[model samples]
Target: MSTSLDTTRLLAALENVAVISTTDLQGNITYANDLFCKLTGYAREELIGQPHSIVRHPAVPKAVYKDMWDTIKAGDIWTGIIPNVGKGGGVYVVDTTVQPLRDAAGNIDSYISIRRVINDLMQNFEAVEFSKETFDEYYAN
Candidate 1:
């Protein structure tokens, strides 16, 4: 009926899935579904306070983040594919959206990231990995 109801339903439908996580502006693990914990091979206690960078895969470029931040800071949402290295050093790809969380005054306070497994997306890219700058340059318009 309403957006909150829709979100709740979505969460319920996807609760058994294990790849979704929500992070705060500081990159703190604010909320991580069971799938996220299982995928990362970390228990809830170990992840909640940790920065998202804990799972940062070396293959991810810094320039992607540079653009990610620039986009979010400007009050826009960022969507792209991210290849992340798991705790056990396994790599996986996902389509990700990083959105700014704004306060009552419309000031940005945090971020909420929604991700979907995108192994197929990776199959389409000839280059296995991309730098952040490289990604930005290609996507810049």
Candidate 2:
């Protein structure tokens, strides 16, 4: 049987392992967790106040972002593997989940995203030629 302490410790470890961030309704970064900053090669200050799109790779299909925004704004969760461009053109990929966060009154307030790096998986996908059609299939609910 797991105690509260065990649950707390598990979440703490998970937080450390995950790259996380929160963005306000306007899509500007509100919080950049340490792992997010480290993985993206950006200082926390550089990320904060910037659009969350700052990390998006140019080649990422626009439809993907559109779908993600539509899903999260409607208070649903969106999950997919995303290719991201880091500071100075560095590249990385993450299995990402973005969801809306609610305020005390149960109104949507902001969005929180949690991601796990999947560089190897993305590399394999790229080797097979990831395409717009494939992306659309992934975006399908």
Candidate 3:
């Protein structure tokens, strides 16, 4: 296949299957894929120009956010299992990877996050109500 065709196919596939969002350097949403919007139960309009934290779940600790910011701000990739709250307050889990997108001048312009739904991988079926206590107990080993 030609390079253009390959690029087209890759984008189509990513659009269909990947939960994707891009945030500006300050963390305002710049773009959101359909899958992301559907998963978060928010429209693209509601997401754009808003902070990416609009979907942040209470169960996530501040330390995690600090770590993620530190990693991505340094032009490194950050990967984690993130639990997000939807428009109606339902919670969902995703295996997420975040990386910086650089401009032509080699300066980091924005961050792109790609995620996969991991609901089936969760042991507890009641993850919608997942809280800090539940998270601690689940990981207590």
Candidate 4:
């Protein structure tokens, strides 16, 4: 018989602590925790096998994700704060990291993104100014 420390429980534990969901190369959701569902307003069935971009918010500058994709595709870890729109059209923020998973041949086979809800610190004027300066430098604004 299997113990409580089975694969499912381990995954559940990871979900309990993880802030976001994990996806495959096709952007299909493979694992999503309760926090993810709550944050995105998406049910498990609605998210699994669905593209992660479904939660992309219009307010978010596309350049951010462009950088993220470039980094992850290069087999690097991407860390940033992302703006996402919920199913109800409500806006939210998350401090996110996208890490690439490699297969036996050391080829990237998937991506795992961990994210945690962040307060709207950008709503502050100073934060906005800092963001403008930083992003301007990053994207040559």
Determine which window of 10 residues in candidate 3 has minimal summed lDDT: 123-132
Q: lDDT of candidate 2?
A: 0.89
What is the Cα-based TM-score of model 2? 0.81
Candidate 1 global TM-score: 0.74
Clashing pairs in 1: 18-35, 18-36, 63-132, 63-133, 64-132
For 1-141, candidate 1 gives per-residue lDDT tens digits of 544667777777777643767677777888877877777788888889799888888878899989998998888999988888768887877788888888899898888777777776567565545555588888996
- Model 2: residues >4 Å from true position, as ranges? 6-8, 123-141
Ranking by TM-score: 3, 2, 1, 4
Give lDDT for model 4: 0.84
Please, what are the lDDT tens digits per residue for candidate 2 over residues 70-112?
A: 9998899999988898887889889999999999999999999
Q: Which ten residues in a row have the lowest lDDT in candidate 1?
A: 124-133
Minimal lDDT window, size 10, model 2: 121-130
Q: Candidate 4 on 1-141: residue-level lDDT in tens?
A: 755588878877877766667889877888877888987788988998988998998878888888988999999999998788889988888889999999999999999999877655656879878888999999984
